[model samples]
Each structure stands twice: as structure tokens, then as C-alpha cells.
Target: MTNKAVLYRMVMDDHLCPYGLKSKDLLEREGYEVEDHHLTRRDEVDAFKAEHGVETTPQTFIDGRRIGGYDDLRAYFDKRVQDEDDTSYQPVIAIFSVAALMALSISWAAIGDLLTLRAFEWFVAISMCFLAVQKLQDLESFSTMFLNYDLLARRWVPYGKVYPFGEAAAGILMLSGSLVWLSAPIALFIGTVGAVSVFKAVYVDKRELKCACVGGNSNVPLGFVSLTENLMMMAMGIWMPIRQFVL
Candidate 1:
């Protein structure tokens, strides 16, 4: 006997339900023949929800048993469900992974080598830009979280708000290998402050707090990863000037 599933999801003129598409795709992937039902109109959606006693669209059923929504379906399939407040390194991992790939690609294209000093430099610079972008997404939230652990931000509240922009500026300048005078100091100053703050917060105070490295809303723990970010910046800051004037 063939396994079968039923899925009801909204498909409106203005908006298509993403979870509905995911549900259909998942069912097919799991070797289930899906009986897909589209509730295209608002009234139809409402009626379907009322009839099934469900609160949301993209409802799924397997073997004549209600399987709830997308998250429920994932749980049914023994997949990890994402929780907003859960402490996860996924965001930082993704940023660093992409940055590494980008750096390697650039090195290959430019210098005909995958692993070069240039590649490492680019990796750090790109990672900085990506991390800064995350914080820039919601500056207010970032500043609020930053002030919790950053000594400078605590004393000077506006420093938290300005940090993302400063990081981005330093990253861009470093990437282009320009304005060593400006970029180097910016990177060094922020990196030094950040390293000290993270060390004090996590080591000295032994406070358990979230890292604002990825973003304010990130669940990444405030510890080694955060310290590494600052250390990388400090390294880049010191290296760039020497590489330019000395080597």
C-alpha cells in the first residue's frame, strides 16, 4: 500500500503560503502521495480552519490523522524544530562558512591559489562585513544587548549604536586595502575594547549572556566565539599597516 498525506494551505492572489509549499514538498520527499488542497480565498481559508478546528493554514494529515502545521510535520518526521530563543551557533556558523567560501573563491580567481595569505585576510574582512550587517539589521536591539556586556557601551550609550557602522567601515576599508590610517585605528580601538569587555564579562564576572557578535537577537553564547571575533579584528588591524608599510 502507498503512503498518502493530505495538506490544506492558502494560495491567495496577493500572497502564497510558504509553509504550504514546504509541506507539499516534504510529503513528496518522504514518499507520500499528497492530496493537496488550496484554500485560495479568505473565506475558504477561514471555513477550512473552522471546520478542522485549526488556528493556521498549511495543515497536514497523514494516514487520516491530523499532523498539524509545518513544525508539527517536522516533529512527526523526527526532525529538529527551530526555536526562536534557543541558543544556537547556526547563524555564526553560516556567516563564517560563507565568508570562507567567498575568500577562497576570490583567492583562486585572483592569485590562482585556494589557500593564500590574501585568502585569510579576505575571509576575516568578509566575516566582519557579514557580522556587521547582522547587527545593522536592528540597531536598536543590538545596542540594547551590546550595552549589557560592553564596558564602553555601558559608559557611553551611543557607542553601542555606532559600533555596527564603525565595524562596516573598517571592514570595507580593509577589504579594499585603502586608508590604512583610518581603518587600522578604528579596527584596533573597537577590537581592543571588545576583547577586554568579552573577557571581563565571560571570564571575570562569569556572567551567562548572549553574544551580540552575530546580532542582538542572536542566541550565540557570550564567550570564546565572541572573543575570537574581536581578536580577528585586532589581528587584521595590526597586520594591515605592517603589510602595507613594511612588507
Candidate 2:
């Protein structure tokens, strides 16, 4: 008995299928002797597809049995099929989680008891600062992407450049528990603008875009997560003013 696999993939001059390369690599990595077959011409590819009764390219066969495409090959090896352009919530989750924990720890150490509301406020403040830092890291890239859907940034270009600084300032002021008058209004205005922009872009206009919240390089989708950040800021903005004036 021979441990052999056959890979039928397209390798045309203008079009080379990535899945085919991945399939070939996977077979080689798994210690199989791969018999490589290339469908270089359009007619050859079309004929192969029609003959195999398959819709897509990069078809694999092992031990005289069909193994399908790249995704199917992964399933054969019990590996997770990765989506290359998929957006993730990991960055947001990590930042918010760390911010919340830090806030809780600080509140506990300072007051000798867990001040839930105060900790929540700190979480929002810290999260804003962390997000602002990400934006500030690559201001030009962040601002360019931000202008795509942000109402203020689209209308007034300088607002995109100033946003990160304003966000950081408000977050720091809130964290210090002072200058509530300045921080509150700034937080409220930005938050409201952000929420509205996200809503219109994602829901109303149905535009699929990346969020500039985490950074310019982030692959986070511009939707629920972005809106949540804005809502948190708005809530904190309202809460801070009331806490300062009333209690």
C-alpha cells in the first residue's frame, strides 16, 4: 500500500488560487507523497471542474478518495479553518477586561471596599484612554480610516486629528476625579457624535467598514462594539456631572 495524495489546482499566469498552495503545503506537512496536478489554462480548469462535478478549484484526493478543498483538507486533519479577513472582538475584549480589573483593584485598595459604581466609572475612563493611545500611535492612519464614516471627521478633517487627544484628556480627567465640568461635556459630545456616526454607517447606510476605535491597524468591525464604546462614554459623561454636582 502507498501513502499518496493527488492535488488538482489552478496555476494560471494571471490567476493562482491560494487555497491550492495551502492544500499542497498541508499534504506535504502531513508526510504524504503529493502528486501535483496543475490546471494552467481556463479551458483545462473548466473541463476538470466539469469532470469532477465540483464547483471550486484546489480539489484534493487521498487514497483514491476525494478530500475536497483547503477547508475540507483542514477538516480531514482536524484543524480549524481560518478566515483571513475576519474581524475579531479580541482587542476590545482584552482592553475592556484589563481596564475593568484595574479599576476594581484600585477602588478596592483605596476605599477598603468594592465601590461598584466608581469602579464602573473608572473602567469606562481607562478604556477611553487605552483606545485613545491606540489611535495616537498611528494618528495619520487612524484619522484617514475615521473619516470614512465619522460624521464630524468627514465634515471637519481636523476633528479626526483632535479626537484622540480630546478622548485621552477626558479619560485622564475622569480618572483623576476632578475637572468634571470640562470632562463631562467633552465626553458627552464625542460619545453622542460617535454613536450617531456608527449607527448611520452600519445600520442606515449598510456600509461594511473597519472600526478606528482600537486603532488604524485593527480589524474590528464598525458596529456593535464601536457603539458600545460610545454609549459607555455617554453614560460616564452623564454620571460624572451628576455625581459631582449632586453627590
Candidate 3:
């Protein structure tokens, strides 16, 4: 009779207890009609699904293309996102990986010119350590987003499981090199690992995520400079072998 209006399968955070209610409260505040599954009767929901062919939940459809769930919904809040079913994504972390490497490279020469070689070594090593930790944080964000919750998070593959450990290993090595008089074998191995780590992460992984690596409130695509930076980092990793022998 009335076009049988409907919406389904959106966010399921158990009242946002794990992270905070801010996400839910903010969504609600935005005039989005949210339906928490825990609040509804199971039988009624099943029946509604059967009646309306409701195949997806926490699903936000602006003019019809399914935008997945909470995360997608948030993404949609940005006008640039055209519609749901849109999966072309880039993460800031990707860009950061590149930028970080470039900074290290340029700083390598500048720090050398300005300070003692030993001092510059410390700066590079410590900078990588911090960046590695930053990558780990991004990993955590990916973990939360990829978990089987109320909607799309379940559909897309989880990525951090493939990358964080390697990055962490790199950080540990670089930090070690920075901190003390380590063997060339160890220093070279770690540096190589860091470089290879970023490359594997960038090219091997599928581009399904929002790239939360940008390290702030902004969400932007990982640019070409970022890609070039990763390549350079990969080279640096290779250079570690030489550095270990020489420096």
C-alpha cells in the first residue's frame, strides 16, 4: 500500500560499549534512523527480512546503492563518496609509509651535515621506531573495522594480520640499531626488513580499506609521492646490507 518503506542491517556494536557510544550517538545525531538489533525481537526481525527480502543489515542506502554499515555510513557523510558498493579506497597509512621513508632519507644527509654521523644515525633509527608504532596503531584500527560486527566489516577481508608483525619487526630492528652498537648483520637485516615490509604492504594488499594511516582527523588517498617513498624505503632496506658493512 505505502511502497513498504524499509532499512536494515547497519551497526552492531553492543551499544558501542567496546569503543564508546560516541559513534552511535553521533550517527543518531546526524538524523540517520538507526535500529540496533539487540533492541528488537528476533522473530519480528526475521519475519521482516522474509517479507521485504531484507538481505543486508546496518545497511545504509542513500537513494539505493547499499553503503555497507557504520563505517560506510560514516564515509558517506563525506560528499565525495558517491554511493554504496563503492570500494575504491586509499589509506593515509600508505602515504605515511612513503613520506616517512623520504623524511628519513633527506634527514640522513641533512643530519649528517648539521650533526655528527652518530647523532644522525640515532635520529633516523628513532624516527623509524616511532613510525613503526604508528603503523601498529593503524593495524589496530583495521582490526576493529574488519571484525564481524553488524554489517560490511564482515564481507571485506582483514588486512593488518598480514602487515603489522613485519612492520613491528622493522621498528624493533631500527630502534636497536639506533640505540646501541649492534652487529652489522643484525642492523642490515632489520633495515632490509623495514624496507621490504612497506613494499609488501603497499603492493600485495588489496585496496579495500579507507587507509586510516594518515594519523589524524583527515582522510585522504595515498598519493604517488607516497608510492615513490615506499619504493625508496624498499631500496633503503636493501642498503641496510651495505650500511651494516660500512657504517
RMSD of each: 1.8, 7.6, 11.6
Report how far off residue 134 is in candidate 1 (Å).
1.9
Instruction: Report how far residue 149 has shifted in candidate 1, in Å.
Output: 1.0
| Tens digits of per-residue lDDT for model 3, 81-103 | 34444433344345445545555
Q: Give candidate 1's error at residue 212 in angstroms.
A: 1.5
What are the clashing pairs of model 2? none
Clashes of 1: 0
All candidates in order of lDDT, best leading: 1, 2, 3
* Better structure of 1 and 3 per lDDT: 1
- Per-prediction TM-score to the true structure, in the order listed: 0.92, 0.69, 0.36
lDDT of 2 by residue, 170-193 (tens): 999999989999999999999999
Scored by CA lDDT, what does every candidate get? 0.94, 0.93, 0.43
lDDT of 1 by residue, 73-116 (tens): 99999999988778988899999999999999999999999999
Candidate 3 yields a Cα-based lDDT of 0.43
Worst 10 residues of 2 by lDDT: 110-119
**TM-score attained by model 2:** 0.69
